[model samples]
Target: MDTEKVTDRKVELEKEDGHALHKRLSQVDPEMAAKLHPHDKRKVARSLQVFEETGISHSEFLHRQHSEEGGGPLGGPLKFPNLCILWLHADQTGPGPSVPPVYGLEVSDVSKWEESVLEPALEIVQSFIQGHKPVAAPVKMPCNEMENKRSYHMCDLCDRIIIGDREWAAHIKSKSHLHQLKKRRRLDSDAVTAIENQSISPDCDKELKEKGSPEQNEKELKSSV
Candidate 1:
């Protein structure tokens, strides 16, 4: 991929109106559009450029990549099958400090580096090499509900993109969205009422006057005679 060209395209896309670009993307690549936020201009542009250059949708390309050997539905294949990650971070201080998992080493204390960081990381690596599971079980985190399962929805009334059924339902029932709906209905009703109450135009009135009632026409004819 040409990084510079992609960057230029991204800049051009950012210069255009985000909503218009989003609408354009939706028409061509609805799946990709659904996955991206409209305001995420860089990514949105990259996807568009992929289509423009290759005549293939970005979503299709991603699907193909994910279908490759050792790949999962969500992402491309791992480079190393036996890869074991060991994360390291400084110890955090707060009311609710999130401690890292077993393989995650805290490098807060230099004196305890061997005990706190090096030893644990070595053990994890050793287990991987020996084809044995680490002493500590891996933590299982739940997948993101929106990214994994739900489809994106755009609310015409509210002029916003909502992800997932629960969020969409909540948005429609929101006070602001309801207010906008009521305002639009009221405007439409008022327009109808105005049209109904409108008086005849001057041209119509003039025509009516010229073609008077039958009795008036008869009187005018007699007068002329």
Candidate 2:
């Protein structure tokens, strides 16, 4: 319905430690890691994600990105031209035609992504999704004036402390946490979905699962996305 619909699926994950990105970038490409731009924070974080997930150089990934863009038969032109440019910019579109990214790996935009920024960001993102301990938390608003201030406990999800009596009551009786508990309780419920057990999700697994008993019954979970 909105831009968030498209974007929210991919979390803007960040790590807790401030320099996690730098460390990850160094692992991906030490030379480029040294020159990352301060402003292009998200790109840096993505570089870290790519490296952590695939253990490849960001440059190699970009090269692969270029190669995969055109949707060429081998290394030639794309199958569909009109959809390539307009992107079929519609609601019901599946994935549209494959096209190359616009970035040229030759110049200024090169060192824009750094690991220093990415690692921490990634830590934050992982912590958010997994609900674990964050290396760093967002800064709180400054207390002022009387300083006696308000009294309320922080929310378990976002950690923002309740400010008023009404908020305090609501926080203590949060239905959202109840929903989370309910979801947790349904982790193995038949109606509840399941994901691959890592080794159980490859093509071999997919094929065997599609054929055999107990495996096919697993139902493959399709796309937890």
Candidate 3:
């Protein structure tokens, strides 16, 4: 299918009437429409255009893609299964962005750059070139009642939802999660220090001085009498 032509047609339909296009998409591909917002004109029109051009719902195409070999619930199979990503950063100890299967390079110290970063990176590349699997195998869950009733866990520190107890345990021990936890502890400590060091406002101090105390007033009255 010529995706570019479909895209152009979708754009034309959206320009004409986005609401009407979304309504048409709902009629032809209710599943896709339910997943997308009514105000998402681009996706709505594209789904409609896809149905008009090929008589097949856009959702069906996605289902087929996901059902292919090496594909699961996530989406289509990886274009490059052996893809290697390397991240070079100055502060390895500090909180860094989260991404899976990444090799981090410490670029802060020039002296150790070769020994720490270059050698390790070279070894990884060489292993990959020699047909050694760079990525780890996926964990296989046992087919049982426990697998069926797997509960989801949400990490408040990292703001991520992890499925299955094993995944949740691994996520908590991950570098990203540890970094975020460290950062959170540091922030809490700073907040406690700030609160402890905080002083009374000038206006509040002045009001307290003006009010004095009941005991002080009674003493003044007794002195006057």
Clashes of each: 0, 18, 0
Residue pairs in candidate 3 whose N, alpha carbon or C atoms collide under 3 angstroms: none
Off by over 4 Å in 2: 1-13, 31-35, 68-80, 83-225
Give the candidate order by descending lDDT: 1, 3, 2
Model 3 TM-score, 2 decimals:
0.42
Of the pair 2 and 3, which is ahead by lDDT?
3
Report the poorest 10 consecutive residues by lDDT, candidate 3: 91-100
**How large is the C-alpha RMSD of every model relative to the true structure?**
9.5, 30.1, 14.3
Q: What's the best-to-worst order under TM-score? A: 1, 3, 2
Model 3 regions lying over 4 Å from their true place: 1-7, 85-126, 133-225
The predicted structure with the larger TM-score, 1 or 2, is 1
For model 1, the run of ten residues with the poorest summed lDDT: 93-102
Q: Which candidate has the highest TM-score of all?
A: 1
Task: Name the TM-score of candidate 2.
Answer: 0.26
**Candidate 2 vs candidate 3, TM-score winner:** 3
The better candidate by TM-score, 1 or 3, is: 1
Candidate 1 lDDT: 0.75
Give the Å error, residue 6, model 2.
Answer: 18
